[model samples]
Target: MPFVICLLFSWFLLPIDSAPAVASDPLLICWNNQVKPLQNRFVQLSYQEQRNELEHSAEPWQQTPYQASGTIWVNATNFRQIDTLRNTTRNRTSFTKTQADTQTLLVKHGDDKLTSVSRAMLDEHPLTAARYSPIRLIEYAYQHHLRPDSASSTNQATCYRTTINQTVISLFIRRADGLLDRATLLAPDDMLGDVLTTLTYQDYAAVGPSQQPTRVIVDKVNGKVRDQVRLTQSIVTDQAPTLLDTPADYRLDMTPTPVATARSEKYSDHVYFVTLPHTDDRVMLVEFTDFVLVAEAPLNSENGELIIQQAHQLIPDKPIRYFVFGHHHPHYLGGVRPFVHKGATILCSPGNDDYVTYLVQAPHRLKPDSLAMAPKPLKLEAVGARKTITDGQFSMDIYHIGSQSAHTSDYLIYYFPSEQLLFQDDLVWIPKTGKPTRISTRQTGLYRAIQQLGIPVRTVIQSWPVADMGVKTEIPFAELAASVDSK
Candidate 1:
């Protein structure tokens, strides 16, 4: 049946139709007949011509005659991991980059004496490999997209593709010129949690005859920053080996220290808070049950990994029984891979589970350490307006956030019956002493939800904490909202 339809559609397209000739400068015409064949997909011809023209240009790829390698070192200042509850300052650290076998090997040493996260990740999880150079994005965009019409649906397209280590990658190009725009890497849930890594192009010049961003900044979209180095320049050369021939050992180094202790804040005997470290330069903690019911997966995979560990430790005597995906974002839910690996039932909102399956779960991306981690089919239970999880005496009511923010869809907030603690990410922020610059309507809606839901929130645990717990009483949700409206 499918083949017959395609044959008919092709037959309908092969014959040309008569039409009046039209002409203009940009020369865009009805070409309705010429273009109708493309209505099923997006087509931009001039783009292909431009690209083919560039691929044939003379560009430098690599510098040969690999010389005896020497190392250049630098001491990083003001470096330490931020804690959800506090900041950790360790000894001074130093980093060096050395060329070996035509590749760069980075060595990090410091007085604070912390293990390098990049080194640890590579060593522990051998499966997840460092992603390819951002340059491939241009090539990927050209090959992967069939046409603009096909790319038009907001939710219809699979956002990315998978790598050898089971990582899903989204490669993008400019909408108009079709120039390589950016490349994004999402970690598999097994290691970190689905988290986004964005590499933006910058500082373009003709590398040979093609334009490319020499200084690229790869970081999380929300400023969960990673590195900021001038790309310096790109060398395109015929000497450049076929991408398949490129050595597999080259790696991108991460500056974060290896996280050693991920502890849960025991709120009540029944409730606990697990802090997740993120590159976004913010602190978020996941709240989960003892036997693994519900996950507070808030941010990216870094946060996702911590929540997974919390679930495991919360009740080491038992495995995680249930996984609660707190919100939906291409970055946030990608980390659920770990829960899928743990074989736990997942609790999520209506559209959320489908989003997870299509965007994150279907990808099953892994990191450097675990090559075998794959996406596991989950037993999903949907939550409507409210859902409750408790142990006879103690309970938490998880409510869907009612706000006009696309920041988090399928967003949920949890309230503790005895602790008077309420959680709603981005709903409100506690202002630190000096008058804050302003607030937002999302913050205002949080205030409305608090009153409307009648949640006796003594402590507001926002996705991004407004103030440290010690100074939380000074939080002004209403003032923050008014500030936004006033602006």
Candidate 2:
């Protein structure tokens, strides 16, 4: 009787224990498929990238191509990438390096200036996170516990959708090999609204136990191909002993220092031309009896803050009442937020309302600036074809450069009638040697605008090349005409 009852119990337990092996979670399956292959290997990848100029240039619709080459080294605990970008059309070359350990991220850009920030900041900023390698992305996702909300399959691949903070990321895994085929990230932009950036990987090749894409194409949802990266080499090896070491000559700073030093030159009693420390960008500050007006907030917020500090030092008693930027280009308008935080009215060119509005209101929780820490409503005013700010005794005219200008349609130039000084940005680039090889349509456009506006101007001040050894910030109008009239 005991043997028969035991046999009956054993038969029922067999069915319960083997209930079809509960289908594995799709998210975990995909994650393991991608990560397990690269678990113990160190990947060294070298690639060359070709990018379109239209995405970053002042000249709209100009698709000039720039080339860049980079190498990335990734292991379990460390990541390092070095990129050299060359713009042959502009005759410029710059080098950048990004490296991260367990606790800190070190970034070196233009002029070999290294800045160290918290590694955790990458978690808060999606655009920065998107620049990482696929191996690094997998590590980041795993570390952050990013779980997929949904998984869907198509004929060719299965895609998993996940959200990291506010950024929406969709990862597509090829059905054949279960490798990452593409990744699309939707992140907010201050100027372009919500930008959909897609990275598609192709030509999967094996490096030791891991597989890497030999070609990667980056595209935007606006039908613009941002860049195409061709992988030249990939290998699995031990990390170099000095792979993450900073060069002894590189300037290292723990805090964000956009401007090393600022110098202000008094162009006149009311107008002072402030030159930024290390770059060719400049700002103009005009003082009134009761308040001050600043023109051309260039670069990032740190650059703007330095300019503000100089403005306060020059005019101690008055608040900054107005902030005017040249156009919508990032080099010109990027620093507008600092002015908005000071409760200044922003005077910008038409069609830039949406862009400027987004700049001030955009969330900066990752690294909060003065404006982000203390919220304020954006006080914006549009400058049409022409507008003038005057205290009756002094007048400065803001004129739109119009569509005839080859640079940007909504460009604006500031003219001071009393000082007989005209201030413009990127309209004319005069060489430091006061000579002309050839004339751009942009230079002639300025002459034509001056002729049509019929404003008397004796001197022209450029909002660039604040001081280039021999270059003068204020050039006589004749020098501009000579360049325009020259062969």
Candidate 3:
């Protein structure tokens, strides 16, 4: 009776082992390939990636990838790569080099310190996961359950779902050949929830004693795809790759610090101009009877905040009533978010509603911007031909250029008829040195638009200044016209 009671007590006190056991054999079986099994071996893969033009703003674009080709040297847990990408819009090209050096999956981009691969890249690529190693997956399964994926129902493929580091990954294996067919990973990001990334392995060919996927497709964020492998050169050498090594001449360019001085220059008695350093983008402040109006909230949120802070310090009495946008390019429009958070009304051009809507809707939880922390209802007013705001003493006219450039489609120019001051963006890039001014096709169009508007202007306030060194404030209208008329 004593022995029976003790056995029952022990049984009640011990933890229940009710969870089903996951077999490592099945996972290893699924990870194998006949041509080339991906394991603890080093691989050098050269692939080409072509980008799709999709404007998603929450994720900042580092490099414009019209077309790029790079060679990757990777082992089980580490890799070094160099990607040469081209910016088709700017007609310029640049190179970005990255490498993983440590055991904790820390990667370094150029001269920067090592950062975790997961934190550095938006997409958790399969190549970075060591696809051939089932040991990691087995260990993960011990902590989390690995079960059959019911959604995958192909005649030749069997799918299994498992969670690794909070990311849900589904692996599809070919039943006949036991090769990795596809792996779909759903990673929940703070900014974008449940971001889907897929890797498809196809066209298996024998490289050495093992088989390798000659063609692989990596489906990235926002429907962008990196597919096709044209080059099939592989070597199983024991020598370390020099391409993986960081060059001695590599240097990271530091960004210019934004000066927080509330210094304001008088464009006129009622109008003030404040130029933010680094980019030399200026914000115009129009003082009215009841409230103040601001023009062109450009660059980023920090820039917008600095401008608004300066505006508040300068005026201190009137509330900022309207925030006007000059053009709808991502470069100039980033500052709109901060103004929106401040309860200012946004006045933009037609077709700009969609872009603004996207701006407010997209999640910024990754970094948690100023606007994201202090949320506000987005107030936007779309104008077509003209929109005017006045308090009898002072008035401002916003005019749509009705001209499209390779830069932007719908551009708006702000005009102060009373001051005879025309404020425009990217129409004419003023030469830093006043040596000789030659007008391009863009400048000619801008001059014609000003003529058509019948607005007499004495001075032109180009959004971008002349130079960082010797910055020129307002340009004489004659100098701008002479450049075109003289030619």
Candidate 4:
């Protein structure tokens, strides 16, 4: 009777469970090629779209360059293709350009991370790895073990998984298809939710030994299908994907990082960081609950590792523990390996194991480190649309956000109850005098979700510039919604 009452009461207001979590069963993928399973079972499964123009080279494309034309689903909603071309330079400057419908605005992305957007129906995705994460959910090729028939397959083949996490995911490509078509992510019983991005390959063609898709289309957030993919060109490279070098001009915005001066003061429970201009991309550290739970460690372990070491200096012997992930971005989560090394279980949202694991281990960057490879195991705590973490005096909650897969799927903006400190990320940056900028559907959607859920938030912390939190002056939520013209 006491245990039951305590459980209910805990949910009523107090802090929930605090035990080391467990590792979920790994996703199992087995194909009895002889079984030939029904294709319907596969969601958004992409095969090689066929084309009559490109020919199969007797040899696999070592550094082959070819062009393709087709349409892509701008989103799961209403999206159509204009035309497109791609220039593949050994995957070095692999460039792709697309024209929208009948209008202008060409969309192009060079290398992998060096992307440009000129009027595509979208901005960033709530889950940058929504598609990629699930792709990891399905296994693929590993290392340089090329399939015997890779060229004839035209980049179409089978593969397997070598790792999984918040960033770079790697798998072994078998039978030829480099991209995933048949794989299964071992998802926990709790993490299966809605499918965010869906891509359907209509047909395929042999482009220099690779089975390249000629008519590949995708589904938008609303579930609409596109017809053609004006693949301007296609290029195969022996080298790895091009990556953007870290900027030297960048410095860790420590306003929220707890400088030596502010370290001794105990204003709140745990400090929060909001990169929303007002403080110039600096983070605002909010001391919550007589303890601290650091959220989103992406500034990389190298830069912020010192923050943890200094926590002892500031809080004396409180024993720093608990780290939370804001959303699942490879770059950000790549920096999280440091925490994993510290034996901290990741606290995340439900329905995101597949995607989050992929980011935690997907392969996108060239240089590989132990951290980049998703070292130690992860401990996860999945929360509901409304869940809180309170140590009596200080309290914070994790709220649900939808239609916001641009940035991430396993996302939760931290909300402090007593201090009224609300930590919101990628949703709205406190404008200069508060003006909104070109935003994302996920960001805009999150703003609506917050108001609809009625989260009793006061001082909002935007954890990027590292120092962007302040006392509640006015209702910034309403103002932010109006800026996005949210309905």
Please give, for residues 1-487, the per-residue lDDT of candidate 1 as tens digits: 0012222223223332222233420001212221222322321110000000101111111111111111111111001111111111222223322111112323233233223334544332211111112322322222333222222122322222323233334444443333445555554343223455666665555544344444455564223334433433234322211112223654556666545345456655555555543322122233343454645454344455566666656656666666665565423344565566667677777666654554343322233222125445666778788988765656778787633333344666667768777755445544545554545555666666667777776666654443343223224344544555665
- Predictions ranked by TM-score, top down? 3, 2, 1, 4
Best by TM-score: 3
- Give every collision pair in model 2: none
Candidate 3 at 455: error in angstroms? Answer: 1.5
Candidate number that wins on TM-score, 2 or 3: 3
Alpha-carbon runs more than 4 Å astray in model 2? 1-32, 35-133, 136-259, 468-471
lDDT of 2 by residue, 19-47 (tens): 11122533344446545566666678887
lDDT, candidate 1, at 451: 73
Candidate 3 has its poorest 10 consecutive residues by lDDT at 1-10
Error of 2 at 450 (Å): 1.2
lDDT of 2: 0.69
Candidate 3 regions with alpha-carbon error over 4 angstroms = 1-41, 53-65, 77-221, 224-263, 404-406, 434-438, 469-473
For all predicted structures, in order, the TM-scores are: 0.46, 0.64, 0.67, 0.42
In order, what lDDT does every prediction score?
0.41, 0.69, 0.61, 0.39
Q: State which candidate has the highest lDDT.
A: 2
lDDT of 3 by residue, 1-487 (tens): 0012223223233333324434443444543433124355556667665653434221233224476677766543456567776667667776766665433233444566544344333234333433322223333433344555444536777666654444556667677776667766655343332345666777776654455566666665533434333435654443346544444644333344456443578767788888765656777899988788888766567677888898888888788888887776544676777788888898878877876776665555323557778789999998788988889878888898755322445678888888788887667755657744445676778888888888999988777653553534467888778877877
